[model samples]
Target: MSVLPDPGASRAVLVGTSQYEHLEQLPAVSNNVQALADLLRGPLSLQLPDRHVTAVENPVAAHAVLGELRRAATEASDTLIVYFAGHGLVDAQDQLVLALPHTEFGRIETGLPYDWVRQVLLLDSRAERHVVILDCCYSGLALGRMSAGTGLADQAAVEGSFLLAAAAETRTALAPVGETYTAFTGALLEALRQGIPSGPALVDLGTLYRHLRLTMEARGHPVPQARDRNSAARVALGRNHANLPAWPVAAAAVADAPAGPDERPWPDPRAIRTVTGFLTALADVRVVSGLTQKAVSGRSAGSMTAGTVGRLLNRPDLPATWGTTAVYLSACGVPDEQITHWQAAWQRLRTQSAPAEAARPAATRDGGSGKPRVWQRPMSTFRRRRDH
Candidate 1:
């Protein structure tokens, strides 16, 4: 007798919305949603079984679209519903709203909350598997105001649903500004494209999270997060699992992994000297994030150039002529709030310094303080001094 595959296996719905009436209002967000949808239908298609994917694009009918999701959830064997890319807003009651086209304004007003999705997944106890991936901002807005540690149900009820939201309540979910992609959805695509499948061969969720954080940092964006009952899921990996995509991190990009007690070697004294000089000069220079005129002058401090500093701080590398004002503010330490404060401080310093910089007369005089005000001076001489 032939062995039958597991009875209930797979089905999915992918929803993407790009066009919005108020293009000026939320163009970036809409565009990102569309891009993520394209990826889901194309390169990421391998994950799901053929033809099991249903995509609804730019639907004018919100109720009908949601009804379809409901139908898919109820009718499919093992279902995964992915809503990739959209801007979400919370109502006065803090309920999350998934936007539809203009016609369904009334329904949107009383739209389904995120918990509704969770409840749908949890209700069917007989279903072997369910996954909901929501890639939108203010995602937690609909999930209720309960703190992170709060139980899924406010009344301490247990639910089997596994949820993966793109970001925490505090972090702003970013839309692709230009070439960039939405941090949340972008990370998801990268994970699906490159994550490891451990057991019988499903893509490993833990590894995906690890890659997501690392990729976001490299792309000059805040990392999206993941929360779920993964350990309890005990998802089995099937054989001949998907392979990771090729992503290159330049040799210079690697930061030595944090040292363990036994493995830790003393950092090179020269690097320490370089870091000290850079920090001292960096403290004096100010760099603002959105400001147009605030330029970062890449001068030499330690081994890193001013350009390197600008890139490190996510600032533009201005000419060395910008003087001390060009120092990009990227404080290196723990406590992220402190880093943000320093970043703001740098901007203010840059603003204060810009005028004084213009006021300074052009060079007609000799040896007036060889210091360029910014630390762009070459480190060759400094190296010599350190050697001595």
Candidate 2:
């Protein structure tokens, strides 16, 4: 668990443009902004006040978005975050611009310039740390035009800033229609909601970026790119305030059990409705058994690695095979009867999840629906590029 400096204040500017005049309308953009805002305000998360968050939706001009960014940068004394979810374009001169509602195709002046946003963030002396999250095509270009003379290492030495972009310079970011969020934002929200594995009271930018990258790649989406300039990687983005007790009474009881075979008071397996709930219960069982992930891995005789155990406990989905589950249970010293209960729970969850998984859209070139609506223009050129 990383300890963060006591940032005096935190502020955020959330911008999302779903309704565009000359470009394709991304319906998921609105949901992306809302979800990020909710997570920032969550009790066990950032805990920012309503006044600290400024949300701009479907702005007609570049100034509308830039004005909010300027305000946040000037007002925030410690931490500032700017998030944009919309269309992005690279001009003939290779400048990246964020598209607004009234932005026209190839009209670089009409869109918000990424350089101007970066300048505002860099010039803000009030904020000690700055974080920029972009979920749009060509967003990686935000850092492309940054001071050319300064290398990434040099930039990191001076400014505490970070950039989280959805794709590389030539790649397109995707926002699947009908989904609550874009692939990148969905992974981000999940990371914040779940917190880091093991015992971490803080969620750092580095951990979040790694999670986003892995999640997007696993789902066959574009690999997200992260640039850490300064100490932003170590700076805490959110607090993990989950109400997990340090020591459970059940754990003490299990520890004091007779030497031959221990009896543990586990929760009713039938009550677990989701894969996360099942993994959490399993984690609790491990805590009661007083075994670390390494210890459990050792108990499995290297059948399962600590990394595998961590993923099994943290991932939203269950492990791929029943054998993995059995090995994990055996490592945790789970009795045969309890293992049977867990197996039943896993079967029920699998039965319920099959239809839901089948209903999801497959990973396509556009990463969205097959057909475009009458008002929407097809992003034929901006196809999704999945990582191998």
Candidate 3:
């Protein structure tokens, strides 16, 4: 199970604007901010100290919010969390801006540019991990910018950072009438309070995101979108209260439970010698994990990406680096022991391919140097090792 952040070393900032001078007011935004602060500080969740959690209500200027974030960023050595609940505006360039209490619709200069938040988290912060949650319309753009276009490799995303948005790129967040909080934040509060049943011992951000996505989809609301770059996916925000002691066994026991329909205990790595066989084995690990490519990438801790995972899995070729395979397996919940075995196998294949490539004719090696020579295990050996 994932451990909670140390209260002493972690800092959180919650900013909300419930009242706007010229635009529509969101009274629920204030509620959202307060409730979340309580959860983060209370025993139910992270249980952080009151001094560590800062809640700014109805800030009149952008600097007020940024100042809080900057302070927390410097003070925190473990984790830093920044949350915003208010109207989200776009600048002339369609960049995200957090609307303040005095900001007007047409006059976006009065609002706080989302980049201020991003830059501080990306460049200014000293914390080991970051979690930024935005509650507003068109917030998915923030997540989109966190990564370059998905590709096989060279995805330079920030490590140990996770961003969750209340709405997708094109949709607007909802604040239902008579509700104490906005739709997005209300569901979040519910998840933190009630917990997910039969979930892991602690409620991780990835698991929490999954629950929110399902809840929003069922309610016909704008489903929240998330981007997790590294170890942030495993950060446990709170204990799973709904997962009671009715099953008093260890957390490891749950993981060792019978496989779901999508999972299988695949063949051993020692039997895989060819690129196709290695790829096939990797795909099997993914099936056992039952996580989406995006989810797997989200937890890879800067190793592989969703596009990279998809590209490598679907292709007949092997990965460009061991980092790709290692992260994929780690993110998919494969044991470190198994991963070490797989790594040896992958290295053995690479070693074999180098010699074969050198020996191959120029035409066979794809212009003599560009393509990797595919590895193949003898048919007799493969037959002897076939799974039952």
Please list the C-alpha lDDT of all candidates, in the order they appear: 0.41, 0.67, 0.72
Q: lDDT by residue for model 2 over 1-388, one digit each (tens)? A: 2323222256889999888777777777898898888877654455566777888999878788888888888887767888988877766766667778887767788898777877787775477778888777653233111111112222222256777777543333356556777767877887777665653445678877887777777886777767887667766666443423344234234345577754443434554555645665565556545667776777787798989888877765666568888888877778888788889988988888778767764442233455433234335522322221
lDDT of 3 by residue, 196-283 (tens): 9767757888999999999989997767777887768887787777863433233244357676552224335865545655765676
Per-model TM-score, in order, reads 0.46, 0.57, 0.59
When sorted by TM-score, best at the front, the candidate numbers are 3, 2, 1
Local lDDT at 355 for model 1: 75
> What's the count of clashing pairs in each model shown?
10, 1, 0
Poorest 10 consecutive residues by lDDT, candidate 1? 264-273
| lDDT score, candidate 2, position 51 | 77
- Model 3, poorest ten-residue lDDT window? 144-153
